[model samples]
Target chain A: MDWIAADWGTTHLRLWEIDADGGVSKRLDSDQGMGVLDPSDYEPTLLGLLRNRLPEGRATRILACGMVGARQGWIEAPYSAVPIAPLAATRAVKAPTRDPRLDVHVLPGLSQAEPADVMRGEEMRIAGVFASEPGFDGVICLPGLHTIWVQVSAGEVVSFRTCMTGELLGMLSERSVLRLSVGSTGWDANAFAEGLDRGLSRPEALSSSLFTLRAESLLRDLGPEASRARLTGLLIGTELASVRPYWLGQDVRVVGEPDMAEAYSRALESQGVAPKILDSEEMTLAGFRAAHEALAAHAH
Target chain B: MDWIAADWGTTHLRLWEIDADGGVSKRLDSDQGMGVLDPSDYEPTLLGLLRNRLPEGRATRILACGMVGARQGWIEAPYSAVPIAPLAATRAVKAPTRDPRLDVHVLPGLSQAEPADVMRGEEMRIAGVFASEPGFDGVICLPGLHTIWVQVSAGEVVSFRTCMTGELLGMLSERSVLRLSVGSTGWDANAFAEGLDRGLSRPEALSSSLFTLRAESLLRDLGPEASRARLTGLLIGTELASVRPYWLGQDVRVVGEPDMAEAYSRALESQGVAPKILDSEEMTLAGFRAAHEALAAHAH
Candidate 1:
């Protein structure tokens, strides 16, 4: 194996082994994300997972990204200020290791000063997008727990905004009063469309609109499927409304899980904006490869 | 004791003994609210709390309001349609009891048909407001887990909207990613005012604005007190913007706990609306008294 590339996020850890030809030879993942580990646990956990895989005679260079570099994670890889390239391999921080065959470098995340925002693992995905389409310029939407919208220019992330839409939807559907109305598994396309329209037209009424779902459930017997779909629609629509300046009259690309990317695609199409959907895992791995190549060039 | 007045809500049960002169002679409370009891558990729980309080060998009439009358509560009192008086004592349902010494009457809640809204406990408080001011014609704001804004005309509930503002604040502060930024206790008036302005002026940007709090905490070292206060301001301000028609150019009365009412009052005042703050407990008890009086009138 030539090297190892890892994306250690808050709730997940994914690793890819690259051969001398720069092709993935093996892939592995674990739930031992940064959220569940102490500062001292990262090296041991990595070593344990890579048992019997590391070459015996030499130290294997492991490139890592994401919350694993957070202040409370394995080690702080201080955020690289933006209006800069997403691949900050030259600025990567080496985490202390006791194992003879382990050499780990955690990549820095991106931060914006004004309207303060920070992203960890997502920068690599942005880098991957730039790798694939070197001249791509416009908004890139990365939807997940903390959805982000980035404006790209000259292969650098010029500006961006983060929306807590995904987290809010999770909390509202599973923990809030709306939980009684919205079931975990259900799909109602028509209800979702209606909710998107309501949210886009009257974003100011978002809070009250949430309560109306519960009221409808009690008074009109609105089914759980419709309720859940509508709730998702409302949150996403509100997010789209807030970020209209980012996607309006611009080339937009959405990189996320298939289902989430599809949802964003539908919402955007309804607003007359055609957004390209990209595979999240593909972008993430490509991003790691780009970072690896940058590190190799610096080494040479 | 002439009779009993009970406010049995989701989380609490508060009872008052009314003398022949229609004044409260004794008061008691319990945490055995409707939420914790089953159909059969209600009778026993009520009996246990009222032990040695009920008159011997004689039936005592218990007039109760709130969630205790919900479909899943002790017994379903059902909901009375709106454009009607808040006090629906004439239509109160009698809960069957095995003990001859118990005669419990559960009051119905209010429901709006068009916008699809329902209120279990707030109706009684609205009735109390009307009881105190017989010819009151204005808007009544009841702030709590489910903050309510009601339009009143000619002693009847004209129309109303329920904002899930308080619940959202709780969920966001205690359960969402914002929990890391906001603390349980502390006050920051200036930060709150700023957030209120931001929320009111640009309600569409709420989802992104919420994430900004977390970023500010990380980047600018924004304290927990300021973050919490700002979160509250944003939510309440958004609610105020949505319910503008209900309070603008109308006599506004806020009925709630001191701290919450004060927050609402300050937000409203900033928009040039002078709202009168009323004691929530006083209104609730008065509403109970009003229901009891109507019951007596019917008996006569």
Candidate 2:
């Protein structure tokens, strides 16, 4: 292996082995995400996973992103200010490792000052997109636990906003009163469409509309499948309503898991906007490759 | 004691011993609420709490309200359709108790057909308000875990809506990413006011505004007290904006605990509406008294 790429998020850690010709040779994933590890545990955890793959006599470069760089993770890589390039590889912070064969670099996340927004792992996806299409300038939406909407201009992230839609949905479905009505599995397309329309038109009624789901379940026997889909639709619709300006007349691309990206596409399509969906894993890998190239160029 | 007035909700069970003259003789409370008890456990729990208070050999009439009448409670009293009197005592359901001395009559809750709304405990507060002022006509707001906005006209519940504002706030503050920013203690009125304005003006930005709280805490050191208060304000403000039609040009009364009622009052006052705050416990007792009177009238 020539190098390694890692995405260490709150709940999961994914790693890819890069070959000499710059292709992914092998991929491994684990549940040892940054959320479960202390600052001092990151090196030991990484070593445990990569001990077999590390070069025998030389330090192997490992480029890492996401919450692994958060204050509570391995080490705090300070967030870079916005209107800056997404792939600032030269600015990556080096983490101290006792093992001679492990060399780790944690990339800095992006932050906006005025509205106070930040992005960690999602920035790499943006970098991946920019790396492939050098002059690409538009809005990019990365939907996940913390959905981010970013505007790219002249190879820089001009500004961005984040919505807690995914987290809210999970919490509401699993912990709130709606838990009884919204189950973990299933989907109902018509119900989703209905909820999406209600959310887009009356965003102010978000809280009340949520209660209706529980009431409908009790009074009308609304099934869990329909309730869950409706909740998903409502949250995404509300998010789309909030970020209309970001995707209204601009070319928009959604980079996320296929299912989630499809939901975003359906919501955007409802508002007369067509968004192209891109694979998030591919983007993250492309981003890591771009960072590697930059690191090698700077070494000269 | 002429009768027993009970308010058995999801989290707590409160009982008031009523004398022949229709006055409260003594009050007792416990944590054995409906959420924790089973169908068979209800009789035992109630008997254990009121064993000493029960009359020697006579059947003691018990008027119970709240979640104790829910489907999951000791026995389902079933919801009474609305556009009808809030205190429909004649429709109360009788529960089968093993102890001959315990005559429990659970009061039915109010439900609306069109909007698909249901309220178990708040109906008592509405009935209590009407018990004092028979000709009362206006909107009554009960802010709690499930904030309810009820419309009353000519002694009948005209219509109503429920908002999960308090539950959403609790889940977000304790379970979501915002948990790091929002603490369980303290208050900041200024930050709350700022959040209120934002929520009222652009409620579509609800999801995004929540993310900003975490960002502000990370970047600018926003205090927990301020974050909590701001979250409270934003939710209440959004609720007020959504239920404007109910309180816009109508007399409004807020029946709740002092602190929560005051927050609702402040939010309403911001929109040029002055709402009268009533003690929830007092209203609940009054509601039971009204139900007792109707039960006596029907028996005679």
How badly does each model clash, as a count of residue pairs?
0, 0
Q: What's the CA error at residue B147 for candidate 2, in Å?
A: 0.6
Q: What tens-digit string does per-residue lDDT give for candidate 1 at B94-174?
A: 998998789999999999988999999899899989988888999999999989999999999999999999989999999
Can you list each candidate's DockQ?
Answer: 0.84, 0.83
Q: Candidate 2, which CAPRI tier?
A: high
- Sliding window of 10 residues with minimal summed lDDT for model 1 chain B: B45-54
Q: Candidate 2 regions off by >4 Å?
A: none
Which docking category, incorrect, acceptable, medium or high, applies to candidate 1? high
Q: What fraction of the true interface does each of the listed models get right, in terms of native contacts kept? A: 0.87, 0.80
Q: Which residue pairs come into collision in candidate 1?
A: none
lDDT of 2 by residue, B202-290 (tens): 88889999999999999999999999999999988888888889899889999998878999999889888889998898888888888
After TM-score superposition, the amount by which residue B96's alpha carbon in candidate 2 deviates from its true location, in angstroms, is: 1.3
**Lowest-sum lDDT 10-residue window in model 1 chain A:** A124-133
What shift in Å separates residue B28 of candidate 1 from its native position after superposition?
3.7
Question: Considering summed lDDT, which 10 consecutive residues are worst modelled in model 2 chain A?
Answer: A46-55
